[model samples]
Target chain A: MKLSDFFRKKSSGSVAKDRLKLVLVSDRTNCSPDIMEQIKNDIIAVISKYLEIDTDELDIKITQTEVDGTTEAVPALFANIPIKNLKVH
Target chain B: MGEVIVVTSGKGGVGKTTTTANVGTGLAKLNKKVVLIDTDIGLRNLDVVMGLENRIVYNLVDVVEGNCRIKQALIKDKRYPNLYLLPSAQTKDKSSVTPEQMKKLADDLRDEFDYILMDCPAGIEQGFRNAIAGADSALVVTTPEVSAVRDADRIIGLLEANEMRRTHLIVNRLRADMVKRGDMMSSDDVVEILAVDLIGVVPDDENVVISTNQGEPLVGNDTLAGQAYMNICRRILGESVPLLDLNGKKGLFERLAEIFRKN
Candidate 1:
C-alpha cells in the first residue's frame, strides 16, 4: 500500500509466470534460445534485402496466443521488426 | 475391468509417491478394492510410506519373473481391509522389468481390484515407460515452482504421445499464503500454464511431512491436505467435488455470505 512501492520491481510470482511462459512455449515448439537467435538472424537477413531494418531493436520469440473463434490457446511466432527505410533497388 | 492409473512427475521430489499413497488410501477408505503398485524399481519408497516395508517379502520383480504368484507378493495394508500394495524391487534396476510384463500384470489385477494406481519414477526413462505402459490414465503431480511446472508440461506431452490421453494434473505442495502475498504461483496459474485439467490441489502443509515420516498416508487424518486427497478420490470416481478452499479466509467469507442469505 505504500506509494513508494508502486515504482518497485515486479513481484516474484509475476516474474516466474513470465519466465515459465517463455520457457514452456519454447519447449513446446522444440525451439531453444539458440534456435530463436538463428531465426532472428534469418529474418533479418531476408528482410534487409527490401528494407533497412533496425536489427538492434528487433524482437522475436515464440509465445502463446489465442486464435479467433476458439477459447484454447496455441503457440505462435511473434516478431517485432522495426524498419528504418526502404532500400531503393 | 478396473482402471489403471499412473502417478508421475518428470522431475524428482515433486510428491508423486505421496500423492499415489494418499489417493490409493482415500479410494480404499471409500470401500473400493484398490491396489497400489510401486514401479520405482531400485529406489522404492512407497512401501515405507505405507508402513509396509517389513511385509514386502516378494515384490513386482518376483511376480513378473515367475518366482511367485501375484497373490503372494501383494502385501495387505495395515489399516484398510481392501487396500494392498505391490512393492517394487529394491535390488533390481529398471531394465529388469519390461513394458510387456507390466501390461500383463495390470491386466491381471484389473479383474480383482476396482482401481490400480502405479507410482511412477521421476524422469522420462525406462522406468517411466514401464510404469505407464499398462496405465489407462495418468495423474501428473507437480508443485507451484517454475521447474516443477515446466517438467509437468513435458510429462503431459509424453503421456499424450503414448496414447494415454486421460491425464489430469495434481498441483501439490502449494503455499496458499505465499500465493496470497504474491510470492508463489496459485493452482489456477499452474493449470493455465500447463494446459491440463485440474483434478485437485493440495496445499503445502507440515502435516504431510509428519504423516510421511510416521509411515501413514494422511488420507485418514483430519487435515486440509487429507481432505483435498479425499476430494480427489471422489472426483476420480466421477463425482464433481469442488476444490478445497485451502485459503481458509476465503472460505470464511463464503460461509458468512451463506448465513446472511439464509436469514
Candidate 2:
C-alpha cells in the first residue's frame, strides 16, 4: 500500500493485462505485429507518392469503438498520418 | 425443449472435460434430465472423467453414422438420476462427424432431454467447429494465465461470430495464493480481458486432481472446486447463486507467509 507503488504505472498485473489487451485486439482483428508493420509500410509508400508525409509521427492502431448506440464495442482500425507538404494536382 | 451448451476452451488442458462432467452431473443432481455428449472423438475422455467409460457400448460416431441408435449410444449414469453420457468413439478422429450432423443431433437431443452438454475439443479446428455447431450457448473455460486467457478471448469472439445465444466464462485452476502475491492473474483479471458473462470461479483444489485420477464423479462436496461447479449449475438454472469468497487468505500456508512477511 505504498504511495509510490500506487502511482507506479507498471504494476505486474497491470503490465500483463495491458499486454494482453494489445494482443487480444490484434488477435480478434486477425492483425499481428508483423502484419501491422507491413501494412504501415505499404500505406506510407502509397500515400507518399502524392504527398510528403511525416512518417515518423504517423500512428496506426486498432482501437475499440462504439458505433452509433450499440452496447458492444467493435475493433476499429485507425490511421493518422501528418502531412508535411501536398503536391499540387 | 432443452438447452444444448458447448463447454469449450480454445487451448488444450484447461479443464474443459472436468467442467463438462461436473456441470452435467450437477444439473442431473438438481433433478434435471441431462445428457452429456463427448464430442472430442478420438481423444474422448469425459466418459473416463465421469466413470462411465466402461459402460459405453456404442458411441457418438456410431450414432451419427447410423450404425447404432442415439438411445443405444447414451449410457445412463448408474449413480446420478436422470443423467446420461453419450460417449465419443476412440477409433474415429474429429472429421468422422461434421457440423451439420452435430446440429441435427443437437436438435434431436433437444426433444427428449432437459439439458444437453457437449464437451468440445480444444483448438479452433474442425473438431472445435463440430463441437460448437450444435450448441445454442457456450461456456469458455480458462486458467488464470495469459495464454489461457488469450485463447478464451478468441473463443468468445468465435462464439460471437457464430451468433451463439449466450457465452459465459469459468475461470478454472485459480491459485489464490499466487493472485494474492500479485504474481498471477486473478478471476477479476481474467474477466477484464475476456469480456464475457462470469459463470463461476474454481479455486485450485487437490480434490479435483484426485477425483479426476480416480475417474469418480465430482458430486457436491466441501471442496472449493465442487462448490464452484454447483454454483455454476445453479446459475445455469436461472438461480442467483453467489460466487465463492475466494479471498486467497484462508489457506494455512498463505496465512503463514503473510505473517512472516509482516514480521
Candidate 3:
C-alpha cells in the first residue's frame, strides 16, 4: 500500500466549504485578517494583565454559531485561551 | 399591486441576467403578467437575452428622462402574451439613472404587471442600489465556486442592510458528475456555507448556452436547466417545490457518448 493510502485526503468540496466558512465569517463581521490579528493581540494584552495565558496556543476567530434559543446562525467571536496561572495582586 | 424583485450577484458572469430572463419567462408561462427590467444600463443584454433587442425604440433612460412614456418603452415578448421587457439604455452610463428614478419607475410598473423582475448589474455600486431601490425582495444568483459564493455572501449582506429581507438563493451552473466524484461542492454544501434559503439549483447544461445563443429562454422545456427554472418560479409563487435531484441518471445521449469515449 502507498503511504498516501494510509491517510485519507479531504475532498475538494470539503476544502472549499472549510475555506468559505472562514472567509465568509470575516466578510460578514467586517473583520479583515489584520483586524483579526489586532483583536487577538489586544485580547492577549488585556488578559495578560490579571492572568498568564499561553499565547502560542491561544486561538481567536469569528465563526457562525447558533444562538441560545434559535436556529438562526449568527457570526460569533470564538476565542480559546489557555490560562497558565493567575497573577497575585 | 405587483411584487418587484431584483436579480443581483456581486460578481459578474454568474448568470444574473440569465436567471432574470428565465425566471421572468417561467412566471409568464404560468399565466402571470411579468415584466423584466434590464438595469445593467451601459451594458444592456436582457434585450438580447429575451430576443427583444431589435424591437427596442424607447429605452429605460427615455422613460425616466420623460423622453417617452413608460408604456412606450415597454417591449412585449412575442412568445408570452403578458410578458414584457424594459430594455436598458446602452448609450448612457449607470449614472444616468438614480435610485429615486428607478423607484418611481418600479412603482409605476407595479400597477400594470403581476411580477416585475429587475436584472441588476454586478458589483454593489450605484447601479446595484438603483436596481434594488423599489424591490420588495431579491433573488441572488451564484455559481458553485469559491469566488462566486463569496461574492454572493457579500451581496446578501448588502441586501439585508437595505432591509430587503425576503432574499432567495439560486445556485447555478452546478456540475453533478463533478460533485458526485467529490470534486465540486454540492448544493447542500453551498446552502450550508451561505446560510441562505435556496430557491433552486440549476445543473450545468449545454442547453442553456444553446437557448441563450438562440435568443430564447429555456422554460417549459424538457431540459434539466429548463425544469429547474420552472421549479424556481413555482417556489416564488409560494408553492413548496422540492429541490431538483442532481444525482439523477444522465440522458441517453450523454450515457452513449460516455460509453463511446470509454472504448
Candidate 4:
C-alpha cells in the first residue's frame, strides 16, 4: 500500500473550502491571471503619460484573505512614479 | 408548512440529482410530506436515483399538458410513506414546460405537502429559470473542485439576480483523503468563495453509488454517508447539529494502537 493509504484521511471540508475561494475571487474580480498581468501593464502605461516612473518597481496585485467569517479581496497598485523638476506649461 | 426549494448547480455532474434524492428521502424519513419534482425534462434521472422509475406512469409533461391530474402524475414512494415524486418526461424536452406551468404546479402542491423539492437541470438557461420561478429557496450543490466552484458562483449570481429569498450551499462528493493530501479543495475554501450559508458537507463515499444502484437512499441507518444525510435532514427541520469532524490524519501507529486497545 502507498504511504498515504496508511494515514487516517483528512476531511473534504478544507479542499472544498479552498477551491471555492479561488474560483469566487476570479469570478468577482473578473480577472484571470493573464488578464491581471495585462491590467498591470495598462496601469503603468497610463501613469507614465503624466510622469516618468521606475517601471521595474511597479507592483499590481489582488490579495484575498478571510477576516472573522467573511472573505475580502483587495486590489492594490504600487508605483514609484518620479516627476521632473520643471514648471507646468 | 410547505416550502419550495430548488436544487441547482450551474455545472453538470455535481450530484444535484443525488442531493435531491437523499435530501428528499431524508425529509420524508422525518415524516415531512415531501414531493420531489424532476425538472430536467428529457435528461431526467431523479426517478432512477429515487428508485421510482418503474412506477413512473405519468410525468410532469402530462400534468402540464392537462392530460392528467397532478395527483395521477405523482408517484408515491414505497420506502417513505409521506414521500412522492413527480417524474420528468423522457420523451419531451425542457422547452415543453413553461415557468408559469411550474409555478402553478408548485402552488397547488404547496397546500398538500410540507416540502417541495425541484431537481433542476444543470446550466444557466431556460431550464434553470423554470426551476427557480416557484422556489422560495435554493440549494446550490458543488464539489470541492475549481470548475464546479466557478459554476456554483455563477449560479449564486443568477439566483441573487432573481431575488431568491434564501439560498444555501450544499458541498457534495467531497473526498477527505484527497483533501488532506492537498489534491482537492476544502469546504472552508468553498464557503469563503460562495459567501453563503452552508447546509451540509457530504463526504465522498463509495456506498453512495451502491445505495443509488440499489434504489435506496443514504439516509437510513447503514453507512456514514447515510448518517450525514440524516444530519442534514435534521438541520432542514430547524435543528442545529454540528458537522462531522472527518479531517483527522492519524498515522498507522495510531490506528494499530487503537486496534490493540480494542482487542
Give the top-scoring candidate (DockQ).
1
lDDT of 1 by residue, A1-89 (tens): 68888869687888898799889888888887788889999999999989999999999978888889997778888999999998898
Off by over 4 Å in 4: A1-23, A29-45, A51-72, A75-89, B247-252, B255-263
Model 1 residue B118 CA deviation in Å = 0.2
- Tens digits of per-residue lDDT for model 2 on B99-207? 9999999999998999999999999999999999989899999998888999998888889989999999999998877787777788898897787889999988888
Candidate 4 chain B has its poorest 10 consecutive residues by lDDT at B242-251
Instruction: Work out the TM-score per prediction.
Output: 0.90, 0.84, 0.86, 0.81
- Give the higher-DockQ candidate: 3 or 4: 3
Task: Score each candidate by Cα lDDT.
Answer: 0.93, 0.89, 0.93, 0.85
Give the CAPRI class of candidate 4: acceptable
After superposing candidate 2, which stretches have Cα over 4 Å from the reference?
Answer: A1-11, A32-35, A46-89, B248-263
Tens digits of per-residue lDDT, candidate 4, B1-263, equal 59999999999999999989999999998999999999998997998898888988889999999999999999999888999999999988989989999999999999999999999999998899989999999999998887888898899999999999999998888777777677777787678667899988888888899988988888856566787778888988899999876544478998899899999
lDDT of 2 at B126: 93
Which DockQ value does candidate 3 get? 0.71
Each candidate's B-chain TM-score, in sequence, is 0.94, 0.94, 0.94, 0.94
Q: Is candidate 1 or candidate 4 better by DockQ?
A: 1
Candidate 2 deviation (Cα RMSD): 5.0
lDDT agreement of model 4 with the native: 0.85
- Candidate 3 recovers what fraction of true contacts? 0.79
* Fnat for every candidate: 0.67, 0.55, 0.79, 0.58
